[model samples]
Target: MRDLVAAFGGELPGCDTPGLLGWLDAFSDEHWNFRGRLGGAERDRVRVELPPRLAAAGLAAAAALGLAGSGEPAHREYTHLLILGGLARSCLQRADHAARLAGALRVGGIAALGSLRPLSAEERALPGLGRCRTEADALAAGVRAAFGGRAVPVLVAPPGDPAAHRANTADTYEFWAAGAHPGPGDRILVVTSPIYVPFQHCDAIRILGLRYRCGIDTVGFDPRLAHPPQPGGAAAADRCLQEIRSAIRAARALLAAVG
Candidate 1:
């Protein structure tokens, strides 16, 4: 925790993991969590824009926190490889990464998980994805592209009430488990974007590992290897900051669940 704070050149006197997580969560809430109080235009107006030096600092902090990795799984075999979904491009990228892993690792099965979240205009317009109307559709397309003749299940969670809330990481995990019924002896590997590793890994641990007693390992897809590639810049710093907040919230929830 101290190392992470120091990476951003910040000091927090004597704080443990939860303490530091809470501090960071509050900081992000103040600066970045602009959902409830700010409308779209107002949120855009109030969004924090990092300069080059601060952007570099954010990147450093993210790397220190394990949010910049595209690491390999610890084992060569698993009961299943679970690919978590995101935006149209992210669904594609993560699925493609999972396909590559399948060739090297012995897995009982592979599944791509997504929410029923509808695609945005920009997502629909991304090259080769015009037909996708929902997140699951893009995931299916990606799995098909990457794992040619292989049969991979593409699972979608239903939308939450007040549709804006959307189905999230936990929801997808729950949906997949209810159908797959993986046993306690099973080991599941998860694939997601590098920036989301910490938060999503926490969710998988809390939901799948704790409940089913199944082992959970999550890794991020290397953007350098992603098809179409992920963009980087000052915006990357903002994303890292946003996901740091996500990791904090997820950790808090996991603690509460365990307790």
Candidate 2:
């Protein structure tokens, strides 16, 4: 809590900052584990805040996953990184990290990618991306270039209306899921920004469990989680709360076609 306060400041709106500090100091693991522990909704409810929300979402996901990694692979694991993308400016970073993860993990399709948020005219004019009319195109080009257009094929999801983006996300997810052919016991990892982990995890678990009867693992790449700035990590992940909320809402739609 002190770290959070220090990272930001002692002043937080609607929060009894000092009192919250004391509350944190007094809170324990017992209280943490209590599922009934809840709080009332606050007033004002302005949604302009993004960074802290992302951070909070990441913390929620980490708690959901518990404190554990499968450890470095002894030989190879089915574990793969599913990257949710955002803008074109982030393509290079996300691509590089995906490559690094592929080098380390026995992933099937190398990487599955998506990001439809368009880049500004100025960003499009940048070298190597001048031809891309939208951010997803730039990301696909950047990711392919990261591997020198080698065997690493990046499945870039098509960008469009809210319904289209949701459909595209599910399509790309199914592509990777089928390509990997995960069985009942196999584990798949959903990789993206920390803020995205909860919603994406919800999508993956609900969809896969319904379709394949398989449990999966999810990880978020955040500055707090990854120090080296990797794809699916904060440096590469997009801060798209709108997209996040949409993804969550669509989790039901994703499974509606199924049983």
- Best-performing candidate as measured by lDDT: 1
Query: On residues 173-226, what C-alpha lDDT tens digit does candidate 2 reach at each position?
Result: 665666667668666665554444555666777666567877666654434334
Residue pairs with backbone atoms closer than 3 Å in model 1 (clashes) = none
- Candidate 2 versus the native: TM-score? 0.53
The residue pairs that clash in candidate 2, if any, are 221-233
lDDT of 1 by residue, 137-196 (tens): 999999999999998989878754455556789988999999999878999999998888
Predicted model with the maximum TM-score: 1
Candidate 2, which segments miss by more than 4 Å at Cα? 1-76, 115-118, 122-127, 156-168, 178-181, 222-259
